[model samples]
Target chain A: MTQVHYDKIALIGIGLIGSSLARMIRKAGLAGSITIASRSGHTLAAAKALDLGDHYTTDNAEAVRDADLVIVSVPVGASGQVAEDIAAALKPGSTVTDVGSTKASVIRQMQPHMPSHVQFIPGHPIAGTEQSGPEAGFAELFAGRWCILTPLPDADPDAVARLTRFWEACGSRVDQMDPEHHDMVLAIVSHLPHIIAYNIVGTADDLEMVTESEVIKYSASGFRDFTRLAASDPTMWRDVCLHNKDAILEMLARFSEDLASLQRMIRWGDGDKLFELFTRTRHVRRSIIEAGQDVAVPNFGRNVQAPTDSAKPD
Target chain B: MTQVHYDKIALIGIGLIGSSLARMIRKAGLAGSITIASRSGHTLAAAKALDLGDHYTTDNAEAVRDADLVIVSVPVGASGQVAEDIAAALKPGSTVTDVGSTKASVIRQMQPHMPSHVQFIPGHPIAGTEQSGPEAGFAELFAGRWCILTPLPDADPDAVARLTRFWEACGSRVDQMDPEHHDMVLAIVSHLPHIIAYNIVGTADDLEMVTESEVIKYSASGFRDFTRLAASDPTMWRDVCLHNKDAILEMLARFSEDLASLQRMIRWGDGDKLFELFTRTRHVRRSIIEAGQDVAVPNFGRNVQAPTDSAKPD
Candidate 1:
């Protein structure tokens, strides 16, 4: 267990990331008391039901009143509103951070509302499943994942170090990056992939010739992989696309240009060019596996499951 | 145990599908003897090393001679060549089927060489992992998956029935479709997904601002799902693209148009449209899970593996 770094920790939104952080903080004894708040009554009650924190409230300001560390874990689109809600209640020297996918947008939304005394550190953990909500969280969510901190140039180093320690206690390796650069990097790595997945699933669903049943039945042929990503929280993704407009548009344009070239190769029956691209992409998966970002098991180990599961392959 | 459906079964091309069929046939006693053949001596040797068949040969004709059933599981581009090589040696009343991804192309390529006395049915098993080769095969590969057979209008019913029995013994639900329809359906379901995956991975790799290390480190946030499909066998995909050009190109055009519209929505900050598309696609994943085409387990059950693996989280 880690040291009790904060006397009180406030989680502004008790969803997947917030609840997960609560679990990890509790497990590691990093916080003496945790306060959880959610805009939805059902989510707030669920957090209380799960015993996710020491205090629970639907009022974001009430949760942050006595907290030394406040983490805003709401959707990117809600970051500014959340910041304004709790800005008056933040402690004098408390450290406030957010776990949002789009760093630049989150910083822009939350930075202005922060008090002059509190240090606002924008952070993102590069880990999650397609699942969401309070019960969808687990203590291991951030384990072995990278947690990025994009602090303002004038932010206090001591406060940044403390936040770094908290993430480390949660089993994440922390890295610092400029928020703009972080946005560009994430556009290629995360946002664009999700956008493409959502787009492809939409395309398949709208196809009159190929029925949805056929798409699902034959999905094991590769379509199902995209479905998992496409099935992600729609609100969160919609917010991401809206908030990270410039970077996402840039990546989308690049992706479309590349796809057009690939289409040209297929149209001309240029087997050699098609083969080259297909072959090169194979190595990227290998690199991801080697880097421990993904497992090397075939079908992502889907073929191996508990014997009692009805879907287990016989 | 299922009854032995064929006295002798010959498998041409000991890759993922061929070796898997050999394993299933052996497990169910579906064949009295199994003969495996591949163009590469290395593949033949690997098949022998795995004891995948009773007899192994690099020569397709020698393997097909006197065999009651021949399943060609080579790259689709090689279907015609294999049919030509085995045509003279195929038993008079035997059934020859192929597990190629594209049906119309396979029929166009193999029909001219098929002997009138033998039955030629083009088939595709809507199942596979990214991994390929002999060692990747398992007896349960076809279990709970769909096997689509596209037979000629004049094909013998008896032969088709026997092939259906064989696939049933291997634990698959069978479906029949016109070859052209099959091509169009597969273009949307299989070929297009793989192509998009390969294209996105290529796009990420080509990004100058986003280092490869950044992509790998942050991959768990949706990018990794596409990597698994992108890592599929290049030769097989290249062949699929070359042989099923028209259908794939048509699907690509449809996909690009839809993507362009989605891009417009993002560009114009149309959150409702984005949310509508994203929400609609979630039902497709639900349908796939309900149909037993995919497991509903989170992260595809990757979180269940033992903790000792190097990639384990904490």
Candidate 2:
């Protein structure tokens, strides 16, 4: 069992990431108790039904009172309100962090309300599935994944180290980055991909000539991969798009510029150029596999039997 | 076991689709004998090593000499050449089919060289993984997937029925579509998704702000899904882009237009627009799952334990 890092941990927004944290903390014995909070009475009752926390309340302030660690796991757009709701109730010397995708905006939203005696560190665990809600989370969600923390300067070093240890105990490897840099990196690697997926799925849905049934029937050809991301929580993603506007716009602009060039290459039947780009992008997947970011098996090992022979020809 | 549908089945190209057909035919006892052929001696040797056929040859013509069915699975750009190479040696009353992605282009490329005595039917199995080459195929690759055939006006009815039975025996549901319609549908469902995936991966690779390692490290956030399609056989995708130029261009234009509007929504903080699009697309994925085109489990059931409860919230 992991060492108890907090006497009472308060979890805000008991959705996928939040409930997953509660599960991990309980499974690892990292907290004496977990106080689950959500603005929605339905969500709070659901968390209670799931037995995900030792205590539950609809009032954020009531949940955070006397809690040593407060974790906010709401949509980025709601981070500031959640912070303001819980700020006056947070225990002195507690550490407050979040699991939002965008770091800079989350920091901007939550930092102003944090008490001077408490440590407010903005964090993003680079983990999740398209599924969300209290019932959709598991203790293993954070295993083998990277959790990035963007702690502000002048934050207590002990508090930062303690929160880092908390994430480590939850099966995440932790890293610190400037919040702005974290936002930019995540904009390219996460936000842009999700937005692109949503856009493409939307495009397919809007096509008149290509019937929706045909698209679904033939989706295994390639389109189904994008659907997983497109099916993610709409509120979470919408907030992300609104919160990280500049970085997302910059990435989207770059993506559209590159796509325009690619479209031109297709228009001109520039086989060499298309081949070059396709080939170069291949090495990135390989690198990702080698880094243990993804399974190397084919089709993400989905439903197909493993091949008996080598994958390479020569 | 499936009834023997052909005296001998000759497979040309010996790549992912070709080798998969070889394995399925062998497992289901659909052919009296099998002949594997490829232009590359290395691929031929790999097929032989897998014992994928009764006979193997590097000469496409030699393999098809006495075969009742000749299945060409080469890249679309090479379809014309393979047809020309094997046209004279094809047995009389035999059926010639292909597994090229773009049916119209494959028909245009191979039709002129076809012999009137033999039936030529262009087909595409909407099944594959990112892995390629002879060794990457398995018998289950086409199970429960769709196989589309676009036959010419003068094609023999008996030959078309036989080919349909052949695909069904190999565990695929068969659909007949006009070659032009097939190309258009595939452009939106298959080709455009792949092109967009490759384009996004390329954009990420070209980024100076986000290091490659960072992208790889945090890929599971969303970028990894695109990498799977982007890592697909480069040669085949390059040929697909070159051959299905017009339909692909049209789809790309539609996609780019939608993306531009979505970008404006983000820039203007139009959460309602974003939320509407995002919510509408979620139903498509649910429809896809309900249609049995994709798995209902989260993350494509990739390495995660099953959730214990319902996915929906009250």
Candidate 3:
């Protein structure tokens, strides 16, 4: 047993990231009980059937009643609503956090609704797959990922430390940052990437020049990467785009302007400019791999002895 | 052991695809003698040191003198030069092909230089990772990929069939299309994706609103996918862009128009339109996965392993 860090932890979203957290917490023995809640009855039933939590309910408030830690893992647009709903029900001194992609917007939406009785630390686990829902989760998902926490000035240090320990037990390396910096960083990294993915995929779909079948067939070329990004959760991404509008637009402007310059290079047949940009970008992939973000396939399945799930090379 | 399909095979330009083919042919025992040839002395020496072939030389003409099959796997722009160099030395009636991305361009560049007695068939295997060089390959890289042949109307069928069988033996499914159609199809699927990836990564790098560090650290969200494509072989991709200009610009116009429409949707908070477009896109990913083009990963291995090379996580 990994050992329980909390007697009761309530998960408020029960979607992909939320469900993954629930599974990991269960597998890691980080919680004595997990109370699952979502706005959808169908999702609640599915989580109940999956045995994703020790307790399941469609009532967000009811889920957090006696919970020691409440994690709100919903779309950014719904964070405020969830915070309001569970504000009165949260136990005194309970640690409250979230796993939303955008931190500044999340804190702005959630912190005001939260009662001072609870510690509201905004967080994001920079990890996930295109798949969503409670059934689409596994315990090993967070084994080596980073989880950033953005806690308010008034937040209790002891509560933050405890939550840090809790995430550590769940296989996350925790880092604390100010909410504004977190928002700006993610605006460039996570939020901008999704917007561009959606944009490019939409671009291809609307094209009359290329058939959809052709796009999918030869996708191994490069277009397929955008499809994975494009396949992300519609509701969740819609909310993120709406919530992080300024930062996203700023990043988008930068992206578009940069693209214009590169396009000029192609138009002018500037191979040297193209070569320089291409060569510089290669170092980033190297850094990502060195930082343990990538595991080349030749080394895959080496230590993995028949994983219990369907994520192999079959 | 796989049956030896040819007595001798000469490979010109042992980069990513060329080196990969050499390895695959060796592993499958399809070539009695594998001759590796490239203009770069460093690479030829490296290929020889890696034992990638039975014969290694820097001269393309010298390498093809006695080979039954000649595979020119250089950047598309270099195809004409290689063809011109090897035209006299090729054994007449021997089959010759290329692994360039642009088909019409390759045919135009290589056809006049070839001996009519030699069956010159143009082929492109729609398979590769972002990495290049002889060491950056594996025998299974072509497994389950599509190998496209764009043969001239007067090209011999026997040669086409032989090349198709060779690709199949190397674990690929073969398809034939007109050179013009191949160029058009690939413009959307492969060329545009790489261009956009290069463009967007350039965008992120030059963004005044977000630091380069921010772009690098938060890449897991969606931007990293673009990075892999941006990090692709510049010379190969630059040639692809330059050679396939008309098709790429057509696709680009469609993409830009579609992106404008989607941008308007986001600007007006048209959730219904946004939701509809986003929802329709998800099926594309499913279709690709069903077609065995993409695989899902728990995370992008910083926290998870990338199940595939080009595509990034949510």
lDDT score, candidate 2, position A240: 96
Ten contiguous residues minimizing lDDT sum, candidate 3 chain A = A305-314
Best by DockQ: 1
Q: For every model in order, what is the iRMS?
A: 3.6, 6.9, 7.2
True contacts kept of each: 0.70, 0.69, 0.48
Q: Write the per-residue lDDT of candidate 2 for residues A1-314, one digit (tens) a residue.
A: 33336899999999999999998888778888999999899999999999999999889999999999999999999999999999899899888999999888888888889989899988999999999999999887887789999999998888888888888778778889999899999999899999999999999999999899999999999999899999999999999999999999999999999999999999998999999999999999999999877888898877465332322111
Give the alpha carbon lDDT tens digit for every residue of A1-54 in model 1. 333389999999888899988988887788889999999999999999999999
lDDT of 1 by residue, B1-314 (tens): 33337899999998999998898788777888999998899988989999999998889999999999999999999998998899999999888999999998889899999989999988999988898999998878888888999999998877787787788778788899999999999999999999999999999999898899999999988899999989999999999999999999999999999999999999999999999998998988999999988888777866543323222222
Chain B TM-score for candidate 3:
0.94
**lDDT by residue for model 3 over A1-314, one digit each (tens)?**
33238889999998888898888787667778999999899999999999899888889999999899999999888988998899899999888999998888888888888887888888888778777888877666665667889888887878888887777666666788888788777877777677767777777776675688777778877777788778889999888777776776677667666766766776777878877877767677666656665554432212122222221111
TM-score, chain A only, candidate 3, equals: 0.92
Q: What is the TM-score of chain A alone in each candidate?
A: 0.96, 0.95, 0.92
Residue B172's lDDT in candidate 1? 80
lDDT agreement with native, every candidate: 0.88, 0.89, 0.79
Best by lDDT: 2
Reference A-B contact fraction recovered by candidate 2? 0.69
Candidate 3 has an lDDT of 0.79
What TM-score, over all chains together, does every model reach? 0.96, 0.96, 0.91
Candidate 2 chain A: minimum summed lDDT over ten consecutive residues — where? Answer: A305-314
